[model samples]
Target: MITLWLFILIGAVIAFFWFGRQIAEAAQQHAVGQAEKLNVQLLSVACVKRRLAVLSNGRLGIKSQFAFEFSSDQQSAYTGTMHLENLRLKKMDIPPHRMG
Candidate 1:
């Protein structure tokens, strides 16, 4: 019984990491798409923060927040944020960038 419990605990740890990785990938993809749509260059998208919270619809979910850096001319840098609810893009906040 002890060994069985240990195995279960190990499995849970692995699954948690796997899920986190998947969420990060999804956030990156969403960030890239947004940058393209806005005609800005995506410098980097990294999962800098995450939290569990009740969404607007009162549904409990993992809110994966990513901080992204972008540039319009590769000389100036700007910051942006992307929020995901269980791997689905819930919202994005990007400041105005200079146009080429």
Candidate 2:
């Protein structure tokens, strides 16, 4: 029925946003952890880029990148980035900064 298809379409839209939110949350957590591991204080985290791509294992998944700000001495802020394939961390690029 048309009503059934309409419901399905709405459900798919909701699911897509929900999935994106899940990935963003995972990226934030991972970014925070990485900053802590480097002994820096995480100031902010935000999702910067996202797209569907084939991962290293050839599995199609959402590729996400998060940009974050951190401070080594709470005085100077530095920028960093984290990349994820779905929920798996692919790479992290941290700018050189003095270690506190």
Best by TM-score: 2
Judged by lDDT against the true structure, how good is candidate 1? 0.87
Per-residue lDDT for 100 in model 2?
84
**Tens digits of per-residue lDDT for model 2, 1-100:** 9999999999988987899999988988998788879989999989889888899999888898889999999899999999999888989999999988
Residue range with the least summed lDDT across 10 consecutive positions in model 2: 27-36
Worst 10 residues of 1 by lDDT: 48-57
In candidate 2, residue 36 scores what lDDT? 72
List TM-score per model, in order.
Answer: 0.86, 0.88
**How many residue pairs clash in all the candidates, one count each?**
0, 0
Stretches > 4 Å off in candidate 2: none
In terms of lDDT, which candidate is strongest? 2
Tens-place lDDT digits, model 1, residues 1-100: 9999999999977977888899998988898888889888899988877777897778986788899999998899999998888799988999888987
Residue 57, candidate 2: Cα error in Å is 1.8
- Give Cα distance to truth, residue 16, candidate 1, Å: 1.1
